[model samples]
Target: FVSMACSSSSFPLMVSISGVRGIACRSITPELIVKYVAAFAYLQITRHQKDLPITEKPEIVLLRDSRVSGEWIERISAGVLQSMGANVLSCGIQPTPTAQLLALQRSNAVGALVITSSHNPKEWNGLKFIDSDGLFLSPESCDVLFQMVNNSAYQYPSFEQRGSFVDFADAAQIHIDTCTSLSYIDLEATKKRNFKVVLDSVNGAGGPIMKSLLETLGCKVIGLNLEPTGVFAHTPEPVPENLGQLCSAVVEHSADFGIAVDPDVDRCVLIDETGKPLGEEYTLALAVKFYLSATEKRGPICKNLSSSRVCDDIAKEYNCISYNTPVGEIHVAKKMVELNAIIGGEGNGGVMLPDVHIGRDALVAATLIVQLLSGFEGTISEYKKSLPQYQIVKLKAPIGNMVPELILADMKKKWEGKEGVTLTEGDGLRIDTSDYWVHMRKSNTEPIIRVIGEHQSEEEARKVCEQFMSEIQNWKAETSE
Candidate 1:
């Protein structure tokens, strides 16, 4: 069934909870979506209350991006939720964060089901479970959902017992209003300055929200794939290569800055005012600067190991503790809880501002960026100028022979005497040096081993990776020889 996800292969359709992905029918069918959603609803309902309220059926927040398959999944999943005696509130084409925020705001509900693959391709689709507190499902809850999915316990009730449906259009508006008002930038000033900004939303949930938020923020925004059509113009990852259009737009229009959000508006990468693709790593860093500037509160900060080291500097500068996790929003969120992080997220432009919400919100990302630039009294480039410059070189290796356990063991053994620094084991291996750090990870979503290194010079960073790869290759050679 995994072959079905490959473009060149045709295989029988099936669903297992690595979470659903790929084309709507060939990979993720309506039946699959319905069953998964129903199973999740069952799990949430049972876990929340020991005694089920007969009249007050458990309510669930249903949300989706602009993917056409989202329509199919939403309708089928809603039917399944209602069938499972759960009240359904549909928030159409909203960012994942909006749904999470709404679910927490409307705390009467059990949890939220977001129909998005996050940064996945146009053909791909997924369901991200958000807890009552507006974060990814806890491990205990996820396990329950997995059990329900596997046991085939998601059954619909009789006609009369079937749960009712209600239109929840205001959920999106409410989220938007909250974000626009929270640490919000002055739209009037942005407009008065005639700020020209280029926005590339990758035709996902970010489209509608970015357009609305930017317009309201008073920027003459030029948007690529402005419609929430889910027809992704390129890879929806918001990486540097996919951001050429945005960079070009900024330069061509002489826009003040360029913003790019992933498929769902949970992450926002940026381009400087000069059309320079600043890369996604800076999004979290920039957001931290803005957030702390807006508020004097300081505590622990959390991020994945693969995130930029700029966070380390920010945390140290602010006299706050910084913790690194493996990856995934759930992992970061967990660390935030432990560290009581004031802010947290990944290097992929997903800034988790706990004050606004625990999850990533690209709308919040946009508003903060706008407000930061407006308050700075200078351009984005000028603001970025104050930060240290480092060139990051990225390379990928196959994960087949490069087992994570083996890699971590070898790394620990090798780096034992080099330099003593903090280390953690969840994703792969990360070692902080006096001047630079290298994070080697096996991508959870992709079948590749990514080696990322950052240093003062490109040559230095690239050489470090090459040397590490050489050592790895040597180790493999010796192991086999």
Candidate 2:
């Protein structure tokens, strides 16, 4: 089965198993989808190079978000996966992190298929594969998946041996329970405060559980986009400009604070009682603070290359360490496994703890936020007032698929000998200086090159990113001409 649609622009820029995302149709076709899933089934079933486990039939967890097409595509994937002798547990229309956590808790499931394109538009959808360990499939697994897809070595189970599907709505509740079980929470204190809360789910899968978690924490909840209808009122990315509804509702209802989760709810950003956006980076930063301070059992923290250096400050207080990995949850998760990290996440507002599985969980993050607010007994604004401050300017522009590598090369050459420039090759090119850092990365989900700069002031951050962006753009144009 030749797939003519698999090209640089059309094919998904698949990362490790958990992050294969891109625009729909162009990136993921029906045939390609089935073959890849079947290939995954092949790899999981064959993972035991030793004697196969007693569970002759491998089990898989199948889940999706609120995207209307999620059901159709998931049904197709289940058919192919089931055909390959993989029993499927359906946690229908769930958040991405929920699927991963459920896969971890279910003794029978060996992997999970999470259908989401995250913050991408409605026309887009994706498949994120998670292993039995609840971590996204490793880099090696993806290589094997693509090869297996091309090899046609997939073994389809016989009629009687074929696997079956079961409806497991309880999976979400199980996930919620596991998250609450983490030692970080003081539910007595949180419930005693009786905080007021407002939330914008962006009409995504987060609606089902984000509000539920808040209510369970004793928050007086006012929720927008709670219907789970996928009729997005904003871009669904939780950026400040797009967060007007959440902020306004916070003030209108006079809520203690407001929260925003992207479509899948794996990431969360915040707004204060004043209706002022705390932005995404602070979500991770606060989580780190609460996580590190919660117990004396401090360990190295893991963070992404594109994230703020606030973790550096937080780590200093504990005399613990921080390891910066590539800008993806899997990379951070791998490092966490290596370092036994206490907490870690991306600046996109995702937080992962070893207590739970390795994934960005909005519910866990929200729980941390509430705990912080409870511990301090102040508004979100007051709690954030004491943290170290830096202004990060985020920018991006279109670049051809081939240009990113060239731009990275030029950046290294151009900034290498500069007195202030120090470089780290984590994801792409992270050029550091005495007081700031700039990272230019090729986005896994989009065609644009993302340029991020953090400095003491917004003006300085802008200057850094603009200079780098201009130099790269001009260099690429000249090379093409």
Candidate 3:
């Protein structure tokens, strides 16, 4: 909640637990990439050397999405790691989840670096750092890396001591094989359904692999923006507003459903058989319902604070525990590991199945959705109707020199002891009521406060979110005065 204004020189370069992102060539330059990569490489080398033999070099897996600048970032990152005496396994044009899986599968790998801005526009690119556990770096680890980057406290090896690089071409196939082999995926049954699906990958890294997965499962795939040309046909985010084409395609093609994934393929959003978006929040909720119903495994479910309450309702139906963490994949993943949760993810169409890997993966979510619908006795829309339904409205407010913590403090006081009101202030201020819940938190990657509210009705959700936004604006005006 600390107010840190961006200087003109670094207007949009965002460094956070989510990783560093900004408009390419402007804020996120080659020099910035080199510094961050070198810092990350140095941190990994130091961390691994503490437990392994000094003679052995740390292996780092490098992957990138299909952004035009991704190749440039990859080359610079690989060279930086190699220069620091870390061997690089370069997996070209793969999704973030694929790189995470590779990092986990490679016994010798010490860490990983993915060059992608995720769902950001094509002009934007950034870096996501993964630890040896195939998870995003924890907040503490990121703090240390940022400190090193700020201080330029990394080392370079001698010419002869520099490490080697290898071009790895098996990442996609390996990821596909692992996903197709999951016990939750009834391959033969899914194939027998012979579902027709429309897939829009936004010409990012998921196109070829997602198409391949559906075809392997015997699905007739209608592909759009599948060329990985780094030129997005529309806004890259797979939200309802950005997915009109996918929705229309689903209805136009008489498909069973439509699927859209972000640039790095970690988020999955779906359109129903009738060409209606199922809402990004339902992605995780549907996955939770399917996992709990389809398997004998009964454990806790974890999601971010901003996720839908329907997930909790689904867990309650199964007599399972549900935990809510701060808004980040690492937090949810760590909580899942601690609780041995069956599944966890963010509400932004990210689904993390521990059985697959502890990362939000579109591939995993898509597979689960396909299987869930294939086994259901009705259409995709009907199946959605069967699940617990909720409406969520998400809006952003500009900070404008107003401190987020101060705004949250006022909100906490305003609702501290109201009837059935509960306030959570760990990551941000979240006010929970019997009917709906509203969360206001600072954006990790943008200079704004995200105000999210969910209720059984869409109008109520929008009203609650707008109320908070109006209050924030009032506070900003007062601050200006």
Best by TM-score: 3
Compared with the true structure, what per-residue lDDT tens digits does model 1 show for residues 219-274?
Answer: 88888877888888888888887788888888998889888888778889889988
Tens digits of per-residue lDDT for model 2 on 183-292? Answer: 76878888988998888999899887888888888888898988777667689788898899889999999989899999888999999989999868899999888887
lDDT of each: 0.76, 0.81, 0.89
Error of 2 at 6 (Å): 5.3
How high a TM-score does candidate 2 get?
0.94
Off by over 4 Å in 3: 1-5, 50-55
Could you tell which candidate, 1 or 2, scores higher by TM-score? 2
| Model 3 TM | 0.97
How big is the positional error of residue 62 in model 2, measured in Å on the Cα after superposition? 0.7
The TM-score that candidate 1 achieves is: 0.90
Model 3: colliding residue pairs: none
* Sort by lDDT, top down from the best: 3, 2, 1
**After superposing candidate 2, which stretches have Cα over 4 Å from the reference?**
1-18, 48-56
